[model samples]
Target chain A: MTDDVAVLGAGLHPWGKWGRGFVAYGTAAARAALLDAGVGWREVGSIVGAATVRGGYPGHVAGATFAKALGWQGARAASVYAACASGAQAINTARAQILAGIADVVLVVGADSAPRGFFRPADGDRPDDPDWLRFRVLGATNPTYFGLYARRRMAVHGDTADDFARVKVKNAAVGALNPNARYRKRLTVEEVEASAVVADPLRLLDICATSDGGAAVVLSSMEFARRHGAAAPVRIRSVSTVTPRFPNTVLDLPDIATDSAVAVEPSGETFRSSIARTAYEEAGIGPDDLSLAEVYDLSTALELQWYEDLGLCAEGEAAKLLRAGATTLGGRIPVNVSGGLSSFGEAVPAQAIAQVCELTWQLRGDAGDRQVAGARVGITANQGLFGHGSAVIAVR
Target chain B: MPRVLTPVVSGWFAGDGDDFHLVGTRCSACGSVFFPREDVFCRNPGCEGGDLTETPLSGTGRIWSYTDTRYQPPSPYVTSPELPWRPYALVAVELEAERIVVLGQAVPGVTVADLAVGMEMRVVPGVLHEDAHTTWTTWHWRPTGVAG
Candidate 1:
């Protein structure tokens, strides 16, 4: 017997700069999920929240706060904080609860109200924090990290600015059909090239913006699904939330240095590669089996990097893969069918769950216009600021 | 009078000129090295935890990658609003002996146009910013052949 939990419902609050509280977005998404699942609020035995650092007290006590917003019926609540991977962690927690028989049905919620401009660390003079030190010392914004990765890809793989622009063009075209996407207009490759550089080698269009948004999912045990009068429900096959192996040689975000590989040899797989590998192992599948993928394309070049890390292409061959039209909508294994972060921007806690929500819709044959034709298996990949690794594999 | 110097984060670097080095912690038992200096214990899981000793990282390393900020980064990274934001290059250098990557701002006057991947760059003393009395000193990376 396969260990599977059903994604009974998926819902979202449209992503954009909606000057409002995260609670409103989260509550609306939660209610929509509950309604779509045909499950009553009182029936939900558990709620797992992906927290936003903003929004005062409610943001801090996310799970309980959402429970209260939904007229609390005494649901067991938990909150997760894993930077960008918070949504996946929340979903994983709910899945664990279902698998353990602790709760037959659980609600997972993620929402964020991102501030304008570059995302900054909390106000402080704490030199102990690496996130703070990165800004204070290097003046490195998120785009600079993307720029470094983009430039490196160019040097090693011979990727060009034209290649980077194609990623944005493709994602933007697909995003035009996504109603929940913050940016619905199609982006031309030339337009992307014409945009001012936010970081050298990476233009403003090459990077995703910060946004306000929310996503919610109603997950239940396979047995609970059948009893609730649903058949052929989309199932979550795997959730990988792992830390980096020691001597993580790749320079990741918010860090000034990579682990020293001099002492011990670095693992063959970089941290990102390991994330997808772990999820594939748990799901008993490979990149060949994926009908679609939703990766954290914080930058167009980074999206190409994910292609290699997720095993869709060999290292230094990402640009070639793009040129072949293999990663587009009608390709053998399409990536970011939901338009990705290139469209929705980053809602931090919400984006990962939003990926799953897209997967759920596509699998159900309900993703109109942007549907991945005959999709059966989907995967999402994202990395948290620190060492947190996240990926999820879903299938029908 | 010589400008008073203060390191943005103390113990991260030391010395005035050619004697300079980035300070990291070396695991006495496993020989693992940590930058941004982890003093608690070795990060390597296989080796038994050992006392972390302060160690100097290699002065020169190959540029793993490099980039520059074209816009002013949001604060805590103090930059004056009145002044036109001058961009600075950032480099991730893969140290030779330590086999670790350390990121630092490229030395003043160095731009993204001047650097290439795998070029040798060495640690040097530089000023991050100056306000009234104190000059916030920070480490910088310069191409090996370039003079500070």
Candidate 2:
């Protein structure tokens, strides 16, 4: 197993359509995290910021923006963008710095004020960009892809809409307990069925909404943590930032096509599964070792997909596991105990970091009413557009 | 004069009716194929790399999956705010020979009810949007045996 980096603190700005700038949310989250860690901003040796688009050029330079907001003390900074996985990339960047001895303590931050309704590519005729081409040529949006996957699961695994609704019902109930969540009301299968169809076979309730939110974490070397008088802090064991192998067969988002598999056979593992696999391998643990998981539930049905991809169960058996209540609070391997993106919607750059925050809470027995009993190891799985894949494993 | 026929994004597809097909590039050494056509380099990592040649992909394939847009897409997709938005089915078709799944909008009136997984589909030209001086053209997927 890779050596662990101490998770000194984790925090978030409550998610919702707050109509604020990303800088405001990010600074709030960073300040909260710093307060929780009992560390002064001036003491931080480095910082990494997950980038968000649509805020002009400063959005791309997130690290500097947050540093300036926190009253920069010459902390080394870096900014990264990997679409949805941007938060995880930021965390990975901070963890790398801590492990590499470049910095004793590094602050990782991700925040976004998402645009309302369907997210579109930046204007201007850029034919070389695939994200632009998909919309310009086919009018395909993100929900459409979620719809296709939801339907395919129905055809392949007999996962009815009822099964999809159960995921929302379960997550919303949990989300209701977390103050950081946007939507807290319990939903019923009937309510899900009655919701308007945003994409074929998937209702509006099944899809996640866009919101303004931010999350941050403080990472430090094990020695630094001990010196700071915090003994047995939650430790991050693995951060999988992997890319898909060539000849990716399954069609993914922001692409008008899948890679042609003519030249080579497709890899056995889908990109999502490979993401979790790398984390499990690096942590020297397996699915059975996980006490809880926080996954990107972009849609309720997508949560079920992550189940099989994370190897919590065999392929096509996620629905069966869900029916058995094996992934709920008291089940064999409770998943998405944080209400997931279903409750939080999406704040783009902030999400993956938010997942780590959930893991920190659960592992430390600080998740309150939603906390898993005696929680230990936890994993978070998420994917970004254009082949960006991420997962993080934490244990205490 | 139809304001001069134009492919919305040029060189991605060409021709008319039965003669139409999507364009791509094939690597000479590894025989790897790229859709939306890769003119620069072969994407296969194992290969030492080879010349990418422009090639026409087969027009027919089976439906890998399908969904319909129930709401108007945001900008860059070009739906008029003035018109009541009509949802269109989007199909991912898997070409057996090329083994690539290409996504496209199903022809008008082709809803999710009319499409099924594994059903046959063929590529055809369709209008994306139009203006006083021009009609933006794009490819659409239609079930192989269906006709208006």
Give DockQ per model, in order: 0.91, 0.87
User: What stretches of model 1 exceed 4 Å from their correct place?
Assistant: B1-3
Residue-level lDDT of model 2, residues A1-396, one tens digit each, is 778999998889999999999999999999999998999999999989999996778799999999999997999999999999999999999998888889999999999999889998998988888899888888789999999999889888889999999999999889899999999998888998899999988999999998899999999999999999889999999999999999899899988999999989987889999999999999999999999999989998999999999999999999999999999999999988888899999999999999999999888899999999999999999999999999999999
Error of 1 at A302 (Å): 0.9
Q: List runs of model 2 lying over 4 Å from the truth.
A: none
| lDDT against true structure, model 2 | 0.92
TM-score of each: 0.99, 0.99
Report the lDDT of model 2 for residue A239. Answer: 96
lDDT of each candidate versus the true structure? 0.93, 0.92
TM-score of predicted structure 1? 0.99
> How large an RMSD does model 1 have?
1.1
